[model samples]
Target: EDQVTQSPEALRLQEGESSSLNCSYTVSGLRGLFWYRQDPGKGPEFLFTLYSAGEEKEKERLKATLTKKESFLHITAPKPEDSATYLCAVQAGGDSGYSTLTFGKGTMLLVSP
Candidate 1:
């Protein structure tokens, strides 16, 4: 079975604070690791796609890095506008056709001014 676990389920930070969220997983025939940011009552917006160990991607204030068994989402100098739920998902082999993402619950962040 494929599984993902995210730590520090909820975080509270002041403006200019920096922190990193963790996502650990177990998958068979690992295909891809994806990171997304989702707002309350909204769908997730893609952030990065990592296909192999040591892969990384970054955008704005967020950086995502992948390893053999886990992935990390690093947030730098976050502002209130950057507060959101960060999600990590992994794609592994499926029973048929196309594979699907096994997503972690998510890490909710609140940045205060």
Candidate 2:
């Protein structure tokens, strides 16, 4: 089975504070690692895609890195608008499509000004 688990279900940050969240996964064969950010009442917005070990992608104030068994999302100097749910998913062989992505519940981030 393919699965993804995220740590620290929730986090609170002051304006400009930065931190990293973890995502662990188990897949038959890794295809890609995806990072998404979702605000309340909306679908996830794509952030980064990591395809292999030692690969990384970044956008805005966020960076995502992948390893053999896990991936990390690092936030740098986040602002109030950056407060949202961060999700990590993996694309692997599944019955759904070419490769189905399994997603973690999410890590909720709240930033206060």
Candidate 3:
């Protein structure tokens, strides 16, 4: 079975503090790694997609990097508005277009000004 786990269920950061969250995954024939951000009451918003090891993607204050067994999301000089839950999911090898994503519970980030 495919599985994803995130460390530090919750994080508290000062307005300009930078940090990185860990996402560990175990799956057979990993196809893709995806990063997403979710607000309190809204659905997760897509952030990045990593198809192979050594790949990285970035946007705004966030950067996501992928490896063979895990992914990292680095938040740089985050702002108060960056407070939200960060989710990591994986697409495993199987039926290409019909595979469902397996998501971690997510790490909740709280930024204080």
TM-score of each: 0.96, 0.94, 0.95
What is the C-alpha lDDT profile of model 3 across 1-113, one tens digit per residue?
Answer: 89999988999999999999999999988889999999999999999999999999999999999999999999999999999999999998765655679999999999999
Regions more than 4 Å wrong, model 2: 95-97
Tens-digit lDDT track of model 2 for 2-112: 889998899999988899999999997788989999999999999988999999888889889999999999989989999999999999966655887899989999989
lDDT per residue for candidate 1 within 1-113, as digits (tens), equals 89999998999999998999999999988899999999999999999999999998889988999999999999999999988999999999777747899999999999999
Local error of candidate 3 at 104, Å? Answer: 0.4
Clashes of each: 0, 0, 0
Give per-residue lDDT, candidate 3, residue 113: 99
Pairs that clash in candidate 2: none
Query: What's model 3's overall lDDT?
Result: 0.93
lDDT, residue 8, candidate 2 = 80
